[model samples]
Target chain A: MKIIVCVKRVVDTETRVKVAADGRSIDLGGVQFIMAPYDEMAVEKAIQLRDAAGTGSVTVVTVGPAAATKELRTALAMGADDAVHAVVEARMGPNATAEALKQVIDGREYDLILCGKQATDEDDAAVGPLLAAALGLPCVAFVHGLTVDGRTAIAEREVDGETERLDVDLPAVITAQKGLAEARYPGLKGIMAAKKKPLETVACDATGGKTELRSLELPPARAAMVKIEPTAAGMQSLLTALRNDKKVL
Target chain B: MAKYEAPDFFDLDSLLTEEERMVRDAVRDWVSDRFMPVVEKAYSEGYFPKDLIPELAELGVLGGNLDYADFPRLGPVAYGLVMQELERGDSGLRSFVSVQGALVMFPIWRYGSDEQKARWLPALHSGEAVGCFGLTEPDHGSDPGGMETKAVRDGDGFVLNGAKMWITNGNMAQVAVVWAKLDGVIHGFVVPTDAPGFTVREQRGKHSLRASVTSELIFQDVRLPASAILPGAKGLGGPLSCLNQARYGIAWGVVGAAMAVYDEVRQYGLTRIQFGKPIASFQLYQAKLVESLTEITKAQLMNLRMGRLKEAGGVTPYHVSMAKRNACHHALEIARTGRDMLGANGVAGEYQTMRHMCNLESVKTYEGTHDIHTLILGRQITGLDAFGAA
Candidate 1:
């Protein structure tokens, strides 16, 4: 089965983020970027499915600025057959991003399309459902496990702290959850081969979407710890403080 | 915990190719995620992290630079980068890869017969069969040309008898690339560890490179067929060539150690308060950090150029000796400065600066000692053998 995985590049989770001078964006100076963690799982799952079939290709597509090619190349290094880089502005919303992906993926022959449940940077969780809706195909969100037999695909999704198994026909969309698959580090051979793999760069005009940003700020600092004595009256005082001062008794 | 910030004052990443950067990053991430967590335990307990062999093989680190059918052959620069990242985690880890690739698999690929290559290369590449190089003997180290190991011609095979000391992976090796004198001339022999009369003893209580395995190998009347001998290696040149390959990697590897120490001390100094301010505010501490960074940057450039030249088949043994000598000397000094900069906290295991400082002592002595390399370069430059007067 042929598979296509959609990925996004975001600031590395380990980096200390700073709000930009303009309150609407994040500061990009001297920050490192990586493929979103869940998206890595999606790419890994696509590769596994392609390899298990023994006669198929896995292609990764992304819509971002020119620098997104790094993440696309990383997907190729992780054993993806090829990559599609849709060069556009980095601030594209979910709808416009899905439209750009659809424009490129429309001409491809694929039995499955996978995406991360959400981008770690934005935490929008909208791109997969939006893309599936626009393509008019069945979608399984938060897929934890998946298998394919002939024309039908079975996906195990996480819902309300429980697993829900769903079987869908071929040519369906799936958004990978945390446990979908563990990504593998790229071997040196794969890294060398990735450079020779086909990477087709296309100019995309899909820019604006319905969502708009207002402002961004850091979370409030945590309150300092308050120590209480171990005596009965101290316990009573603690309870009184919890009920009276904090109002959470 | 904060992420490791590799010191790159010279913007060396800009000079690297995409493949080089990706390869380095892959190993760096692996070291951070897997190796760093276990390094202290392994070092304190004095055991090599043998379980990581399969993972390293999966990452294509073993035999990574050889040109076998399935091997990566990632070129010298990429291989050097792999060494750099591994050494950044710990010297013992890098030593394992060096011994496996440059010393063991390389000789088999370059000199062994087709049958021998087909037999051991795949196994070693996959980490199914661990291999060790047996050339440093009890009586011979700096001058391996005078090795006393004998391979007496007997029937259709040969009977070997000798002892090799300071053998890395000796206790765990399934095969050994042994160099012995055949009719008073050096020849390479591939000996299986399970052969009769072959014995291995692990050395204990080492203060340096404690996370690595070091053993003494004894061979008493061990017999091998004629096919066991490497067909192409005829003299000391064979083993010396392998040392050159390893030294090229060492030149790059030690820079990683220096960078690690430098980065650690720099971070610590910035936050550590002394005299009502961060200790980094002092000019004396700044001098140490500045010197460390400068030497590491120079070492990085030297190794990168050496790797490129090696890829182009233009690197000489003299050049490798120079790079190895210079890099090791400066790295050791930097580790010392970093250890002292931490003051009372330097000796604690919580900070890896002292661990790196101890490991560099062995790195300075192995492959080729800093002084030996200096003599080799001295002889090359002046066309005079420094040892001839003796």
Candidate 2:
């Protein structure tokens, strides 16, 4: 069982993002980058599957600039057998990123492709499905639990207020959800071994996509709260304000 | 529910390699999750969390730098960062690793015969067998050459009689690296704790580093085979070299303790209001924070350069002495100031500042005292023997 896990490098969620001077993107200066949180789940799941089977390889791939190798190395440190970096000088949309990934995976004999349900920065849950369509393979989205046996795989996905279980065959793409697996911290041995592991980089040709960014701006600041007493008179005033002004009472 | 935000004012993260960062993150996460939850309680209760030893071993922190065939070899910088992260959780935790790695396993790796190495290194690395270095005796702390422990050859074995004081992990260790005089010359012996006439007594009522195990080891007519002596070491140079290794780790470990305290106080000052405004707005509080940050940054650079030198070889004891003295002194001062910034809350163990403050007191005194290191540096520069008579 050969598995390919797709990861992304994103600004740490703890960071306070600022709009770039161009008004169309985020400022990258002094920002700390980390492996996308959700993608960590995908990488962890791939490693776990390989470990449980006792005979398989887990390969991690990322689509970004050359600096993205840091995230790839992090995955490798977490027990990925090898890594591939599809180098793109500039940021690309989900479709273009998927196409780059398609090029990287074209010649690989992979039984499974794992990815995060959505990238934290973009929040567009389209890459996995798009890549699956491009590769002509079935896709299981938002997988929370998964088990594989022979050529068949069983996955548990969380739908809108419901749990859906699906049976997908081999050569499938699975997008990991938050509950899929808890990512393991790489031990000292793994960190040392990762330095010697195989990491290949391939330059990707980005064919422009349909989506275009218009502008990026910070959200409006929230108004300060108006404290109200629990007394009947205070409650009556609050109700009157909500009914007349806010119109939600 | 306090969060840990590592202080990297100088963009120091850029100086570390990806592998180093991974190792740091792993140890940092483990310390936060496993050590932090119970550290205050353990300190207050005056008990070491022995349960975490297996997990710590699983993380490969014990003898982390030793090139054991079973474990991947980590560079000196990565190993130093591991010590830093452990100290961030608590100084006692860091001391445990320092004593186990630098003082115990390091001597065996550098001085033990092949058979001795094959017998002890693997078990020590796995934490299956705890080991302690016995050099600081009851009468000798700074001057180990004055130790009275004696080992006399008797046919195929040696009979040892002596006592070691302030020995970390002494009571819990299964094996001890005991330094004793053999034929009027100091030598190291691998003495098992369970040997005949061997006794260990735990030191009680410690105000500093209370979370660690401190004990006294006594060896009365304890016999060991001829092979027990470390063949590669002779006279006082053997144990002194081990102390040097431990001191290098101490230099890096104190920085972690200082960072933890500085981070805590900075957050407390910003949120703690006095006279209707946060104290951080005042110049007095800012001065303390600035001093701590400056000292921590300087210590960090010193440790990084020292780590590189150690890895490249040709690192002298005086070089380690400077770093150890500087880092420990600054860390003690930072912890005290951090405690002061906490006001009444500083006295509370719940805040973690006072605990670190007390722990830093032990760190400043152990491995090598701040004054001792200063004299070492002073002698290195002045070419004077001020240590014996001044």
Candidate 3:
């Protein structure tokens, strides 16, 4: 099972993000970049499938600037065989990113294409389906559990609080959810080995898609809490305040 | 409470290679996620968290530098970073790795016969077999050469008799690399823990390194085969070389402990209110923080240079001694300052300052005391042995 996992390098979720002086984008300074959490699940799942087959390759593909190779190398360190960086100088939307990934993955004889359900940065869940459509393959989204046997793939996805099992044929795209598998920490040996693994970079000329970013701003601060005593008079006052001041009863 | 943040004041991450950063980040994540949650409880309970051994092995931290075919052969700097990250959690955790990797597996790899290496290295690497280095006896701490543990030549094997004290992982180890006198010359012996007449007793009531398992090993006429002796080791040079390896790791490990305390106190100062504002607003606290950061940065640079030299095979015992001494001394001071900065909260384990401060006391004393290292440097510069005489 030759698997290709699409990953992205995004600012760590834990980072305290600040808007750049330019109103259109976030400040990159002092921000730590890590593999997108959902993409980590995808990469881990690909590696697991490859390992279980006992003979196959797991190649991680990312679309970003040269610095994105750090995330690619990290994926490789998680036991992927190689990596492909579709180099994009500017931030690209889901369609352009998917187009770049399709270009990089062209001519690769991959049996399975995996991607995160959504990138945390934008939460744009369109790339997997877009890429799969462009490549003319069936797509499975929000895959929490997946198993492949011969040319058929069985995937379990949670839909409306119920698990929906789907059987997809070979050459399918799957977008992994959180519970795909617990991502393993890259061992020291794997880190050292990742340096020696092949990482190929292809320049991508990504035209802007239909989406445009007008501006970025911090969310409004939360309202302060209202405290009331435990006495009946305090409770009556709190109820009156909630009904009149906040307009919620 | 604020989350614990690691302080990397100098952007030292850029100094490391990509692979080095990955290794460090992985260890840092593991330590923060797994070790931090349980360390205080483990320390208070006074027992090593043995459940973490498998995870440590999976991370390839055990014997990480040794070139076992199945194990990760990380660079010296990477290995040092592992020690640093582990010590960031606690010194006892770091000591466990140091004893296993440098003291036990290193000797077996460098001195043991091919057969012996094949028998022990893989098991030790996988954490299936825990091992300890037995050199420090009850009477002998700094001067291991005067160890009374002796092995006499018998028909085919040697009869070993002696007591080793303050052995880390002593009670938990399945095997031990013991340094004993053979015909008045120090030699290394691989002794199984379950060998007849060999008894291990846990040393209880330790305020320092309480999370670690320190025990006493007594060999009462224990007989071992000739093949059990490390073939490539002879005289005091053998154990001393192993100590050098461990000491080099200690040099790096203490920096992590210092960083932990420095980070904890720095956070505490920022949020801790006193006299109308955070204590961090005070000049006294600022001065202490500056001092600690300065010392930690210096130690980081020293260890980086030492690591490179060691990787290049240009490092000498004197270099290791200087680094170990400097790092330990500065770490102790940083821990103390950090403790003081926390004020009354410093005495509590919840703050983590007191734990690091207590752990450094043992770190300073072990792997050659700070004074012993000073004499080592003193001898190197002055060409005079100030160790024994006035």
TM-score to true structure, per model: 0.95, 0.94, 0.97
lDDT (10s digit) by residue, model 1, range A176-205: 998999999988888888999999998776
Evaluate all candidate structures by whole-model CA lDDT and list the values in order.
0.92, 0.90, 0.92
Query: Which consecutive 10 residues in model 2 chain B have the weakest lDDT in total?
Result: B381-390
| Model 3 regions more than 4 Å off | A232-240, B1-4
lDDT of 2: 0.90
Error of 1 at A5 (Å): 0.2
* Candidate 1 Cα deviation (angstroms), residue B72: 1.1
Ranking by TM-score: 3, 1, 2
- Deviation (Å) of A44 in candidate 1: 1.1
In model 2, residue pairs whose N, Cα or C atoms come closer than 3 Å (at least 3 residues apart or on different chains), thus clashing, are none
Q: Which lDDT tens digits does candidate 1 get at residues B1-90?
A: 357999887888888888899999999999999999999999989999999999999999998999998787888899999999999999
Model 2 reaches an interface RMSD of 1.6
Which DockQ-derived CAPRI band holds candidate 3? medium
True-vs-predicted CA distance for residue A14, candidate 2, Å = 2.8
